[model samples]
Every structure is written in structure tokens, then in C-alpha cells.
Target chain A: MEFSYEVKDSYAEVKADGRLNMVSAPKLREFVTDVIAGGSSRIVVNLENTAFMDSSGLGALIGCLKAARQAGGDLRIAAVQPQVKMVLELTSMDRVLNAYASADEAFGND
Target chain B: MTEVLAERSFRGLAEAEAIESVHDELDGLWNDAPFVEAMDQMTFTTAVIESASNIVQHALPAEAQRPVELGVDISVRSTLLQARVSAFYAKPPLGQLEPGTPDEDSESGRGLALIEALVTTVTFERQDGTNIWILSKSPQA
Candidate 1:
């Protein structure tokens, strides 16, 4: 998976473009950590460009979210495609993590 | 970035990490309007990715740095989605594929079990040191 990051007004938006599964899960975690370490407290994960997710990837995301929260920040999701939304719902993560219709919306820009 | 447009061939076990993203990726694919109400494609995609990861993390961990090839294809026929994942890797240890004894809290032994549960059928074939896994699923109609 290819990851692109950009700072948007008040959030560090990370766009993950590609599939996230067993192999790329670590990279996602590491990248998110790197971003967190870089001092971006509020993180907005743009899943609009991502096409897949698995148990491992889900675990990684949850791990990151927990970490980010513990560090006094939050990991919010934006533009999660419907299919992806199903899994999140199945796992009940949609309730735990706030999902937004768009990146700006996730940041409460509305 | 391996853009999986319709279908894509993943060349090696090193890409196994990418399989971890199957849940979300397949979701995105199935999110297309035509599949708005079901998870047929999502199930198949997850199965394939889990199977592929098993081969990479276990079957070829020793030879991981060596060239191990993987090919993936996805298609829908008769309201069913099929995912064919063919891979090349060093054969696993004699008992490695025979399920594991991980604690309930562990994730090590879940890959194969998960794949089996997701896919309607799974066929494994090994020829010339290449392992081919054809995983197919027909989600509830």
C-alpha cells in the first residue's frame, strides 16, 4: 500500500492508497506511529482510496487508535467506502471510532 | 503501490503484509453500487488474503528474502465472487500446515481456520515448488 500524508488545518490526514492486510498492516501501524511521533495529535485516516481491510489490519487500526487516544489524541476515520463500512460495523468498530462522510467532516469542520 | 484494478498479480510473499488490508480493500470493492447490499466479494477477498499470508509467514519464512511469487484474480460469475491466489514459496515444515495450538488469545493459528470458514471451497496444489491456492466463495444470495 502507498501512504500519503498531508497536514490539514488541524489534523494530520493520512491517505492510504492500496490494500491493507497481513503484510501491509505493520507498515500501516509503523507509519501511523511515525506520524504520531512526529507530533500530530489529531489523525484523520482517509480510507476513501483504500479498497480492502482484514482482521490483522483491523487489529492494527484499533491498536493505533488506542495508542493515539492514550497519548491524548484521537484517530478518526473519513470517507470509508460502504464495503469497508460493513466490516467495521460487523466488528462494531464503527461505534468505537468516529467515522465521517469526508475528511473535513471528520475533523468537525462542518 | 499495487493498484488492484479488477484484478492484480502480487509477485511475492513479501507482499503478504498487504493482505492484512483485505478487509477494508474488499469492502471498498464491494462498496460499488452494484453490490450495495451484500458481502459476497468481501468474503472471498478476505479468504484469499488470509491463505496467502499463511504461506508467506509460515511456508516461506526462511526463504522469504528469496523470490516468492503470488498472483491474484477476482471475478464475479452467477452472483458469486471468486478469488484465485497462486503463490510460490519454500514448502512448509512437515507439520506447519496442520493447524496450530495457539492460546485463545493468540492470532497465530487463525489464518487457515479463517480462510476455511470464509471460502466455500479451498483447493491447494503444489507443483514445481509453487503452491497454488484457489479460494472461492458464494455469499448468501
Candidate 2:
């Protein structure tokens, strides 16, 4: 998996492409944590290209969400593919992650 | 006897990288058997990867100085998909095999329940120091 971020006006948009499995879960958490530490608490993880995700990957996302909230901000995901959406719903994490239609909409109206 | 239309097998050291390799194998397996329904393929792949990931994360070596190896055998039949995910050279799992209902805030402990929900049936067995999880799913008609 590969991670890149752009600090938008209201939030940092992190694009994660490729499989979000156990192999890359920790890296994701670290990447998002660094983004939050860099002072952008409101985050939007773009998963448009993330084709796959396991429980480990879901856990990493939850961890990142908590980190953002602790920093007085928020984290949301957008463009979730079918497989990721299935995992989130099955594990009941979808209610907490709060998926949006796009990165722009994630922090929109906030 | 069941006729397997497509199958994939992988065995390697139970490490983080092995998960990716197994996932690659699953992707190939789907290519080999595109006749399988999309939902069946999706659900079965998730269950297999979850089982394999559990081994890598928790399975311990049965003997000192020996590393645990992950083994996966997945097959697609006319109407069913199955996977045997194993932990080679591993000791018996210590905790409950049952899935837990973790609160929404928890990050882990959801893999087991997710697997149960995805597949039709899940069973475990131990033989010759290897622990195996059998996950099977019946394709939608």
C-alpha cells in the first residue's frame, strides 16, 4: 500500500491506495498519526483505490479515528469500495467511521 | 466426491508479508474461476484472509526455536467455496474459539465474528501440531 497526503484548508486528505491488510495496517495508523501530529486533526482517508481490507485494516482506521478526536479533530473515510464497505458493516464500524461520498464532503459543512 | 473447478494453495512462514502473498493467491484463484458468484468470491476471500491473519497474529510455536508456518488451501466447487487455513508447527490456541461481541469502540476482536458472518460454517481441528480452520461458503443460486 502507498500513502500520500495533502493538507487542505480544513482537513488533511490522505490517499491510501492498494490493499489495506495486516501487512499495511500499522503503516496506515502511523501515517495518519503523523498527519494529526502535524496539526491537521480533521482527516479524510481516501479509499477509492483501496481494493481490499481485513479486520486488521479496520482496526487501524479506528485507531486513527481515536487519535484525531484526542487531538480535538475528527477523521472520516470516503469512496469506500465494496469489500471495505462489507467489512465495515459486518464489524459494525461503519456507524463510527462515517463514510462520505468524497473527501470534499467529509469535512464539508463542518 | 466434490468437483473442484478452481483451487489455490500457499504455505509460508506466518509473518505479516505472508498475508499479502495469500491475498495474491486468492485474487488469482478468482481469475481461474470467474464462474463463481461475485458475492461468494468476496465473502469467501474475506473469511480465508481473516483466518490466515489470525494465525500470523496469534499462533505460537509448539516447540522452542521453531517458527510457525501458515498454510492455506482454498478450492471452488460447482456450488461451494472452501478454505483450510492452518498454523503449522504451532501449539494449540489458548483462548476461546468463539467469536466475541466487542463494543463499537474496540479496534480488534471482530475478526472471528466477521468470519462467522461471511461464511456458511466454521470449524477448527488440530492434527500433528497444526491447527486448522475450515471455512466454507455456499454460493447463491
Candidate 3:
């Protein structure tokens, strides 16, 4: 998986493209941590290209969410594909992660 | 005897890379059996990868001389998808096999529960120093 970020006016948009599996989960955590350290706590992880995710990946997202909140901001996901959506719902994390239809809509009202 | 419409097998060192390889095998299997519903393919793939990832992350070597090897055998039949995910040269699992209801903020402990929800049945067996998890899901009509 590859992670890249763009600093929008209110938050950072982190684009993660590829399978979010055990192999790539830790990297995602580290990448998002770096983004937070770079002065953006409000985050939007674009999962449009992330086709698959396992438990480890879910854990990583939860960890990222907590990190964002600790910095007094928030982390939300947008453009979740089918497989990732299934994992989130099955694990009851869809309620926690809070998916939006698109990146622009993630922090639109906030 | 059950006729297998398609099958795929993989054996390798139980580690991070094997997960990707197994996932690739699963993608190819789907290509071979395109008649399986998208939902079935998606759920079964996730369940198999979860079981394999569990072995890579947690399975312990049974002896000093040999490291654990992950072995996966997946087959698609007329109306079913089955996978035998194994950890060779591994000791008996250390913790409970049952799923836990972790706190929402918890980062782990959800794999087993997710697997159970995705598949029709899940069973475990340990024999000859190999621990195997059998997962079967019936494709939707």
C-alpha cells in the first residue's frame, strides 16, 4: 500500500491506495502519525482505492482515529469500497470510523 | 464425492509476505470461478486472509529447529467455498479460540468474530504439530 497526504485548508487528506492488510497496517499508522506531527490533526483517509482490509487494518484505523482525537482534532474515512465496508460493519466499527461518501464531504460541515 | 469447480493451494513461511501471496492466489481463484457471487468471493477472501494473518501474527514454532509454515488450500465447489488454513510446525494455540467482544476503541481481538460472521462454519484441529482452521461458506443462490 502507498500513502500520500494533501493539506487541505481544515484538515489533511491522506490517500491510501491498495490493500490495507497486516503487511501495510503498521505503515499506515506511522504515516498518519507523521501527518499529525506535521501540524494537521483533522484527517480524512480516502479509501477509494483500498479494496481489502483485515482486522489488523481495522485496528490501525482505530489507532489513527485515537491519535487524531488526542491532538484535539478528528479522523474520518471517505470512499470506502465494498470489502472494507464489510469488515467495518461485521466488526461493528462502521459506527466508530464514520464513513463519508467523498473526501470533500468528510469535514464539510465541521 | 463433491466436484470442485476450482482450487488453489499455497505453502510458505508464515510471515507478512505470505499473506500477500495468499491473497494473490485468492484473486486468481476468483478469476477461475467467476460464477461465484461477488458477495461470496468478498467474504470468503476476507475470512481466509484473517485466518492466515492470525497464524502469521500469533502461531508459535513447535520446536527449535523448524519455523512455522503457513499452508492454505482453498476450493470452490458448485455452491460452496472452503479453505483449510494451517500452521505447520506450530504448537497448540496459546489463547482461547472463542471470539471476544472487545471494547469499541480496542484495536485488536476482532478477527475471530469477523470470521465467524462471514462464513457458514468454522472449525479447528491440531494434529502432528500443525494447527488447521477450516472455514466454509455457502455461496448465495
Candidate 4:
């Protein structure tokens, strides 16, 4: 998967533009951690183009969330595709990660 | 017996790269058999990848000289989708085979549960020295 980030006013938007599987999970964790360390703890992972994600990918997201919170901020996912959405709901993690319709809306209310 | 309309298989070193190749094969299988509904395709692909990923991540070499090999055989029948995900030259699976209810914050133990939720049935078999996960899902009408 390809990862790119932009620091928005309230959060850093990380765009993951491919399959988030075992191969790319660690890369995502590393990329997000760097973003956190770069002084933007609040993160929004844009999954608009991420077509597939397995358990490994989900684990990375959870790890990233913990890291963001530890840095005194938060993390959210936006524009989840159907397959990713199914995995999230089935694992009952939808309650924790919480999906928004768009990146702009992720930190909009906060 | 249901006749298979289309089939695909891959066998290689049980590593991270194998997961992508298996996924590519699944995508090709879908292209060959377009009659399967979108939901079935999505769910089945997830289950297959989950099973294959488990083998790559957890399966250990049963012997010192040989490493584990991953094998995936997926077939599309009239109304059923089936895949046998195998780990060759591997030891028996460790821990309980049943799915655990992890807390919302936990990340690692959700794979088996997700596989069960995605398919109609999941069965595990260990024959000779290979561990196999058989997953089947009936297409939606």
C-alpha cells in the first residue's frame, strides 16, 4: 500500500491507497508513529481507496490508535470501503475506531 | 456433487509476499466467474486471505531442514465457493482453535473470528504434515 500524509488544521490526514494486508500493516504503523512523533497526535486515516484489509491491518490500526492516545491526542478512520467496513463491524471494533464519512468531518466537530 | 465452474490454486513459500499473490489469484478467479454476487466475492476473498495470512504468520516449520509452504486452492461451483488453505511441512496449530472475544482495544486475536463470520462454514484438518483450513460460502441469490 502507498501512504501519504498532510497536516491539517486539527489532524494529520494519512491516505492509504492500496491493500492493507500483513505485508503493509507494519509500514502503516511506522508511518503513523512518525506522524505522531512529528507533533500531530490527532490522526485521520483516509481509507477511501483502501480496497482490502485483513486482521493484521486491523491490529496496526489499533496499535496506531493507542500510540496517538498515548501522545495525548486521538485517531479516527474515514471513507471506509465495504470490505474494510465489514471487517471492522464483524470484529466489533466499529465502536472503538468509529468511521466518519469524510476526512473533513473526522475532526470537524472537535 | 456440485460441479466446479472455475478454479485457481497457488503454492509457495509461506511468507508475507504469498498473501499478495494469493489475493491476485482470487481477483483473477472472480474475473473468470462473474456470476457470483458481489457480496459473496467480497466475503470469500476476505476469508481466503485471512486463512492464508494465518499460515504465513503463525505456522512453524515441522522440521529443521524445511520451511513451511503455503497452498491455496479456490474453486467456484454452481452456487458454492470453497477454498483449502494449507500450510505444508508445518507443526500442529497451537492454542485453542475457537475464536476469542478480545476487548475493543486488542488487535491480534480477531483473525479466526473474522474468518468464521465471513464464510458459511470453516473446518480444520491436519493430514500427514500439512495443516489445512477448508472454508465454504454459498453465494447469495
Candidate 5:
């Protein structure tokens, strides 16, 4: 998987493509931890290019959410595809993380 | 000889979306074969995807470049699907799930639990460097 991180205004937008399975979830968490460790607690994950996710992927998201919250900020998700969204909804992640229609919207929420 | 409809080597990057695609493929396969049926597709897909994804995520935390392989097979006899999956992963603990918070409202972590609930039989095998899973599904009585 390829990931690109950009700090847009106040939100940290992480754009990812490819699969976010078990192998890649930790790498994603490392990136998130680095962001929070850097003092920027607000985060938005742009999964527009992501085609798949699994339990491990969901766990990583929950892990990131917990990490960010502990750091006094929140993590949000945006541009999740239909299939990906189904997993999130099934896992009930849609309830805690604010999902926006676009990255702009996710960032705009703050 | 077996026919191959989908074959790809993913670098331990099996995430939720990948799992969904697998489900979609099986859904399509349902029309062509009886190895997989509608009643158990969701459960089986969820289990397989979660299982594959777990391997990709945690099997080789110390190694950076080990690629995880996923192989699937389907056979139908009297509308009973005998599905075989080969993967390289460290197995989850026996017979129970480590609690995870997917969201209070989400019903997702039930991957393995759901898998066990839906399939007629579930088996896990580990050896050398590959894990093999055989999940059999039969239509509801």
C-alpha cells in the first residue's frame, strides 16, 4: 500500500491507496502515532483509493482513534467507498468516527 | 485440474475492502457453482477476509518484506461447498476472540464468531510457513 500524509491547515490528511489489511494497519498506526506524537492531534484519513479493509484494518482504525483521543484530539474518516463503508458500518465504526463525504468536508468539520 | 478465476499475491495487505472483494467474487461464483451458497456467504466471506487480513497484519511483525499468499478453492456436491484456503499467518488464539471495540453500534468484530456460526464446519491448520483453512458450507435445511 502507498500512503501520503499532508498537513492541510489544522487537520492531518493521510491519503492511502491499495489494501489496508493486517500487514499495512500497523504501518498506518505508526504514521498516526507520529502525527500525534508531533502534537497535531486532529486527523482525517482519506481512503478514496482504498479498495479493501479487514478486521485488522478496522482494529488499526480503532487503535488510531484511541491514540488520537488520548492525545486530546479525534480521528475521522472520509471518502470511504461503498464496500469499505459496509465493513465500517458492520463494525459500527461509523458511530464514533465522523465520516464526511470528502476530505474537505472532514477537515471542515473542525 | 482446477480452474482459476482469481489469483493474486498480496503483500500481507489484506484489509476489509479486500475481504469485501473476496465476498463479491464468491457471490459471483455462486451462480456458476454450488460450492458456496447464499445463506452462508456473508459469514464465510467475513471469516476468510478477517483471517487473511489478520495474517497480513500480525504474522511477521519482525519481518518487513514477507509476502502473504492467499489461495482459494471451491467445489460443489449436492449444493454443499467445500472451500479450501491456503495462507501464511499466525493463528489467532483458540476458540475465543480478544475483545475489540468496533463501535458500540457496529456488529463487525464478529468475524470469526460469525464464521463459526454460519458455516457447517470450520478448520484451521498451521505448519512450516503456511496456514490452511477449510470451510464447508451447506444450504440451510
Candidate 6:
């Protein structure tokens, strides 16, 4: 998977393109942590192009979320594809990770 | 027994890259069996990948010189999708093969449960130093 980030007005939008499986999960966590340390604790992971995610990938996201919260901000996922959504709901993480329709809407209220 | 209309197989060292190969095989299998329902395809694919990933992440070699090898054999029949994910040259899995109940914040321990939920049946067999998980799902017609 490829990761790129842009600091938006309220958060950093990280675009993760491709599969978010075990091979790429650690890289994603590292990338997102750097974004959090870059002074943008509010992070939005855009999964519009992320077609597949296994439990390892889901764990990476949860770890990233905790990192964001530790920095006194938050992290959310947007544009979740079907496979990712199924994993989220089946694991009951949809309640905790909080998925939005778009990056613009992730931290829109905050 | 129902005939298999489509199938895919991969055998390689149980490493990170093997996961991608198994995934690619699943993608190709779906194209070959487009008649399978979308939900069935999604769930079965997830279960298969999860099983394959588990082997790569956790399976330990039975001997110093013999490294574990991941093997996946997936087949699609008229109404069933099945996969046999194996960890060859590996030690028997430690402890009971049961799912864990992790709190929301936990990062790991959910793979087992997620695999169970996605597939209709999950069975494990240890034969000749290989740990195999057989997953089967009845495709929605």
C-alpha cells in the first residue's frame, strides 16, 4: 500500500491506496504516527482506494487511533470500502473507529 | 460430491509476501466463478486471507532447518466455496483453538473470531507436521 498525507484545515488527510493487509499494516501505523507527531493529532485515514484489510490491518488502525488520542486529538476513517466495512462491523470496531463518508466530514464537527 | 468449477492454489515460504500471492489467487478465483454471490465472495475471501495471514504471523517451524511454508488451496463449487490453509513444517498450534474476547482498544486477537464469523464452518487438522485449517462457506444462490 502507498500512503500520502496532506494537512487540512482541521486534520491531516492520509490517503492509503491499495491493500491494508499484514504486509502494509505496520507501515501504515508508522506513517500515521508521524502525522500525529507532526502536530496534527486529528487524522483522517481516507480508505477510498483501500480495497482489502485483514485483522492485522484493523489492529494497526486501532493502534493509530490510540496514538492520536494520546496526543490529545482523534483519528477517524473515511470512505471505507465494502471489505473493510465488513471487517469493522464483524469485529464490532465500527463503533469505536467511527467511519465517515468523506475526509471532509470526518472532523467537520470538531 | 459437487464438482469444483473454479480453484486456486499457492505454496511458498510463510512470509509477508505470500499473503499478497494468496490474495491475488482469490481475486482470480472470483473472476473464474462470477456466478457466486457478492456477499459469499466477500466473506469467503476474508476468511481465506485471515487464515493465511494467521499462518504467516504465528506459525513456528518445527525444526531449525525446516522453515514453515504457507499453502492455500481454494475451490468454488456450484454452491460452496472452500479453502484449505496450511502451515507446513510447523509445530502443532499451542493451546486450544478458540477465539479470544478482546476489549475494543486491543489491536490483535480478533483474527480468530473474525474468521469464525465469516465462514460457515471452520475445522483444524494436524497431519504430518502440518497445521491445516479448512474453511467452508455455502454461497448464497
Q: Please give, for residues A1-110, the per-residue lDDT of candidate 3 as tens digits.
A: 99999999998999999999999999999999999999999999999999999999999999999999999999999999999999988988999999999999999999
lDDT of 4: 0.95
- Which candidate leads the pack in lDDT? 3
The Cα local distance difference test for each model comes to 0.67, 0.94, 0.97, 0.95, 0.64, 0.94
Error of 1 at B41 (Å): 3.2
Cα RMSD, each candidate:
7.0, 0.7, 0.6, 0.7, 7.0, 0.8
Q: Deviation in angstroms for B89 in model 6? A: 0.4
A1-110, model 1: which lDDT tens digit per residue?
A: 89888987888998988776776678888998989898986899999987777656666777778767777888898899865676566555677778898888887853
Supply candidate 4's per-residue lDDT for B37. Answer: 91
List model 5 lDDT by residue over A1-110, tens digit each: 78888887888888878777665777888988998898778889999998767666777888888888899888889899765776766655677767888887886745
lDDT of 1 by residue, B21-135 (tens): 4434455556542442355555666677777666556565327567665556565555455666666656534454554443422323555666666678887777777667777
For model 2, the superposed segments whose C-alpha errors exceed 4 Å read none
Candidate 4's clash total is: 0
Among residues 3 or more apart in sequence or in different chains, the pairs in candidate 3 whose N, CA or C atoms overlap within 3 Å are: none
Tens-digit per-residue lDDT, B30-141, candidate 3: 9999999999999999999999999999999989889999999999998779999999999999999999999999999999999999999999999888999999998899
Scored by DockQ, the top model is: 6
| Higher-DockQ candidate of 1 and 4 | 4
- Which of the two, 1 or 6, has more DockQ? 6
Show model 3 residue runs off by greater than 4 Å. Answer: none
Residue-by-residue lDDT tens digits, candidate 4, A10-83: 89999999999999999999999999999999999999999999999999999999999999999999999999
